[model samples]
Target: MTVFLCDGECEYSYDDLLRHLNQDNYFPLLKTHHLFSYFGNLVKALTNDVPLVLLDSDLSPAELDGVDESLVNQSIPLSVKRLPSMGEVIEALVHSTSEITMFTSGTTGQPKKVVHSIQTLTRSVRRGEKYNNQIWAYAYNPTHMAGLQVFFQAFENLNTLINVFNRTRSEIFNLIKKHSITHISATPTFYRLLLPYERAYSSVIRLTLGGEKSDGHLYNVIRQIFPSAQINNVYASTEAGSLFAAKGENFQIPASIHDMFQVVDDELLIHRSLLGQSDSFRFDGDYYHSGDLIEWINREEGVFKFKSRKNELINVGGYKVNPGEVENVLNAIKGIRQSLVFGKANSVLGNILCAEVQLEEGVRLSELEIRRILKDSLQDFKIPRRIRFVESFSLTRTGKLKRL
Candidate 1:
């Protein structure tokens, strides 16, 4: 009973997906299918290739050329399927080969190839009748980790998925209304951008936020929009598959993994079990130090809040400032819709903090007035020296702010 909507126009059913996957060949680079369809074929491919690479449909020819030659030489479209024995394919997938290569979201830096086994990717995924019969929205790029997570959830629970990638905020809202999408997992930036689009969110039963830090301001707005939906902010990375989830704004370490992580000098560290067996990251004894900084809310109770990435810290004449902290404060303002804070090069102050703000419809506030409000909460160096109004903020493929 699986149903999929592509680009808000085309509709495909479970039988159609099975027919396509049964006919597709594994030797060639498969032409990308609509996000959901792509995952269907990905499951088929896993049983054959020792390592398979998928190129996103949105990538340009030049971008396509940048991928490994080994993958590109054998490319085939999703429509060109080669029939194979299902039992054999499943057996091959489970025991013969397990590695699947995927690219990073490229929010922090250039997108790089990351290899993760199917088992590692699905290690933390939950399955239950509670998730069945739900209509999930696939909002992330299909090739990205978050997108894969959404697909895995639907696949494991036999839930319907609607592809909402490459659509405008207004269009996405319409799709949600049309399909009655019950569950959605996306970055905080995606939710913020979607806030202004007026629509009926009563159909959304669960709303999960990840890929970026969530703040109280964003949480309150989502609460107003999807009043009946259960809202949670999840913490996961490309390197660390689904880690922790918090019901409210602040991320709290769950009891199951409280001893699995430690805060060393405000930076979060993870035990090796949480990470894929990859040599790319440095591990000390059994812990891989996560570069994210945290502020303890209740250290004894395993409650803490994410501050900012260590690299995202701006040094203004030796005074360190976290842009996320400033952005969070700015977002709390009544009329402010979204804000981005970054360091601007300055001769005197090594780097001066600057902010770009997007305001709510018809809302007008002066930079001085904004600063006046910020002054009440933030210290002098932490305040952005320059503030400018903008229509929108640039987002990565996965809908996170493109910081780097």
Candidate 2:
């Protein structure tokens, strides 16, 4: 279609969307931010046959510049239009299998275009029916993987997807209370941010954390706020796709549920998956090896406690430090709401742990206080060598804490 408005506004009718689908028009109007991804898929779709398109509101100026030029050169038949809500967007693309697309955050590296049919996109809709047809205060951008899942969830059940696209911490809190939000899926850092506004948005039914790791400490904090909510920590990749998710932190997938798991040398391997594009979901072994580290506390437990990500470990000094260990301590501090631990070069330690955190509003803490708090739970070597307070940390499209 020509224009698919995606500023979380404008609700078009079915007939109007149909006209766009058959001819060249627009349904769910997207913002300029989504134009880059839309252009990328549009370019690919022109080459082959791609039905669905999702445009995440991310990408650098260089990437965007490439898209703008490519569009002009290809002379792609597309334009932009304004739409009101998610309902109208679904109505237009509901009937067309080729018109549905899902956007991924590209954590492994470069973002690749993955297109899915309406049948594939809607496969997990009813599967997520626990949150079906209910009022959902969408906390994520409607452009990433989480956003696409929520979009399809609303489309399948016709739920009132309250478009809380760019709500601030204060604004999101107010909206949840005002709109009576029931289900939620955000990064662990986002949940930590809600602690300040906990009293306002405590009446949650379901809470899911993805794009980042979660420990017992963070899980307990969320449990305190959303007592009745079924909190979940999910593990899904772009190549592997999302099928079933764990109900809470440390929850493992049952073999009966998903036989795609295999552990070797303490590393998890998931080859057979049916989530992402068909090209990504193929025949040979059909596995996506998750480069995650794991250890078993006890064989009798029949499950493994999740550990550091293999690719994300920081090689500080001669010894290596896992960021998750430091992040756990940071989350437990009194004034610190959320923190990310990463390594930066140091002449002495080779590499030292550095922390960027957000302090609780109206609360002040010196670097010494921050270090002392970390010292209470973490080892001396693990404490941040340099501490910096930030208003907010970077986030991926799927609500993961970004290590910028």
Candidate 3:
């Protein structure tokens, strides 16, 4: 029988999943680093149609505002009739009425809860014989939206998942070869970290990037690493599941839901029907400001390109500069592995742009040289005033570069 998951030294089969589901009880608010246990609990709750709250393993009680600390990781007895097989359990989970509670990153303030049903969570998952027996490099924090997306996509198809999240560079490559990982769906930053491209991993057949805006330079590098792979990007969020799919940088909205979106002053507003229910979500009429700034490629056909987040724009001397635009320029430069651009408070400019750059191994780039190159491509105000060369960059839980 095909292994269900390969997490470190631990290997779990579909039989193990069945045994776990047949247990007398399951945790409703689980917080464990053990991926199998977490998944087992998740499956139990969904199959039994019991409400569940997903919490990051490292999350503290202070981080989660309203959750009772005493109840976390505590199990509730299950009296429902046990399923005879794993297939039956999966079927029950697919048609589950479970309301799953997940939290935002709380980048701006306290983490807010968003609730979603199994249908909304698995809307983008495509299951078929063509998708079966594929080995996936699980590269996401299992508590987050992207992680859940990948989990359902693989699990529903009974595909094998090899956990690679937070693994070292050498370890990740070793596991890829050992397991013949065929598909990888992660943030661009995760791919960027495997820089100074070594040998090609021909085993990878499909690569999906999401959680951050990626540039052409990253795509080019990914193509070289996974020559046989078909590269794509997914547009998903905590408030909503996957909505649009992109090849390079352009996202084409499905025509069936074309009337559900409205672009006002470059900010994309989404209809309430396309979103998960959340008390934290503030809607303007039937539309909610998505805070995503998009440029129309063909507004009539619902084709568009994501520019940047509205709140991510930095104001410098009465001018608004998108950090992603500058980072794209830096990333395109030869010998630069990755770049992070952000704003710093300044006495005169209110906010002065700054960048942290990670160069390819043995690469020597002066700060002045980078500034000179930027002058030709960017306006005076748009260019970062300060640039710092770094060996590594700080990453968020989702593997995206953390912006200060």
RMSD of each: 3.5, 5.9, 1.1
Global lDDT of each candidate: 0.75, 0.60, 0.90
lDDT of 1 by residue, 120-229 (tens): 66665777767678898887877777877777777666568887765677778888888888999988887887765354589898999887777888888887778779
Ten consecutive residues with minimal summed lDDT in candidate 3?
80-89
Pairing residues by index, what is the TM-score of model 3? 0.98
Number of the predicted model whose lDDT against the real structure is largest? 3
TM-score quality measure for candidate 1: 0.88
Q: List the residue pairs that clash in candidate 3.
A: none
lDDT of 3 by residue, 98-152 (tens): 9999998776667889999999899899989999889999999998899999999
Task: Give per-residue CA lDDT, model 2, range 298-386, as digits (tens).
Answer: 44434566787888888777777889988888777777788888899888878888999888889899988888777767777888889
Candidate 3 Cα lDDT to native: 0.90
**Cα-based lDDT at residue 73, candidate 3:** 79
